[model samples]
Target: MKDNPLVIKLGGVLLDSRDSMKIFFDFLSTYFHNYSRNLIIVHGGGKIIDDMMKKIGMNINKINGIRVTNSSNIDIVVGALAGIANKRILSYLKRNKINFIGVSLSDGDSVLVERSKKLDFKNHTGIPKSGNPKLLFDLLSKKILPVVSSIGITKYGELMNVNADLAASALAKTLGADLILLSDVSSVLDKRGNRIDSINREKFNALINDGTIKNGMIVKVQAALDASEVLGKSVQIASWKENNEKLKLLFNGELSVGTFVYK
Candidate 1:
């Protein structure tokens, strides 16, 4: 259990649902109190950032479903993700009496990142180079949940915006943790609007090639694949909207509710 913690990546939309979030926290509280499992949460705030950017008349852009972040937008990204978004999650945890510490990829150099080299988008966007999970291990050993935001810092101390799914993947890989990516959708769907219960790398590639999976879901599936390959295990892509019993069963390895990405 110490070697493998449960890492859950939450989508930004979940934060907007007060009732859903309350129920989710209630489940978490009960689960933590009854079990000795170590848990880590990584969250996104894309919707919140987009709303903030709209209020400030800042244009938000994306390339291939990944946010095109520049130096001009980095501060707003941090404020939205690390500041407001992180605190909002903390507030919920506090309300639920769950012990947690809010953190970012910058904390303790947990996730060392470099400018994304694959895509020539804008500046200040990063891909995880490596991660040091000592800080996470220390926190987990003390029974503290680390709620991380997807904001990374460069070696020169420049802040960079990261895709939350990839950020979660980096942390899961570093910590040798089992990952569960919680999205608004219950599962990945086929072109005919059917849920895909499981996918392997080859099938995933076929889906992308045939245009079955596109946009942000592409990024998510890619991250899930990467984590699954690294961990030599399947990663679950489930819904944040699931009921407490379903979520509990899913986490306990008793029920399968969503698409499982395998190596």
Candidate 2:
């Protein structure tokens, strides 16, 4: 696997956990500085968006874990994701003295999106059709981390909401970077709730068929599988809740703290 650059997808739950976020960013900043690894962060703001919607008296809906976003919802999503969520992450990075740039998938046309074809949810939900990785590449080359919000824009100048895991997959494929999906859960769990250390495509399919993996995990696993297959490498689904020592071991390849989805 190419080692210089890494793409990490951060779940919304991380944003809600102050302590976890503190440790994560502290370790991340130091890791980046010490290792000089190029990093790109794609973040989800679903919980924040949900809270925003609740405050505005707007009902929220999801279809198969992907939000059902209409035109009206797009405004709220953008405000929550691109606006509040993105800025808050930037603030943390700033306080930590991390060199970073906050951007949307639409920035510099980094990702070209089309209305999601797989799900017939609504008018403004999108999936990345293609991406121009120039901006990301340029930033990474200069050692600047790109903190991306999972918000996209179409050719006709319409904003759309994207599933952050899928967005990270698309970006990883485009940049040929290692993909790491960090979430609250330690790793993909089995029916008995034990963490599965490794999963190949066949095992992944089996788990899905047996209903061992459902809900949001379905999307995360799918994204990891897609990146693994397209990039001919493994994608990791790890926990942000792990302490710094565990995280260090994980980065050094000494301890496997997560499920490795192999091609």
lDDT of each: 0.86, 0.83
Provide TM-scores for the models: 0.93, 0.91
Instruction: Return the top candidate by lDDT.
Output: 1
Off by over 4 Å in 1: 1-3, 119-122
Instruction: Give the worst 10-residue stretch by lDDT in candidate 2.
Output: 247-256
What are the per-residue Cα lDDT tens digits for candidate 1 across 85-157? 8998899899878889999987888888887877564587888744788999999988888999999988877
lDDT of 2 by residue, 1-263 (tens): 23656788888488987877787888887877777567889998899999999999999888777788997788999999988888888888887888899999988787778887765645888888447889888988888889999999888887889888778877877777777888897899999999998998799889999999988888788877877776788889999888888876666556778999987
**Full-model lDDT, candidate 1:** 0.86
- Candidate 1 lDDT score at position 125: 86
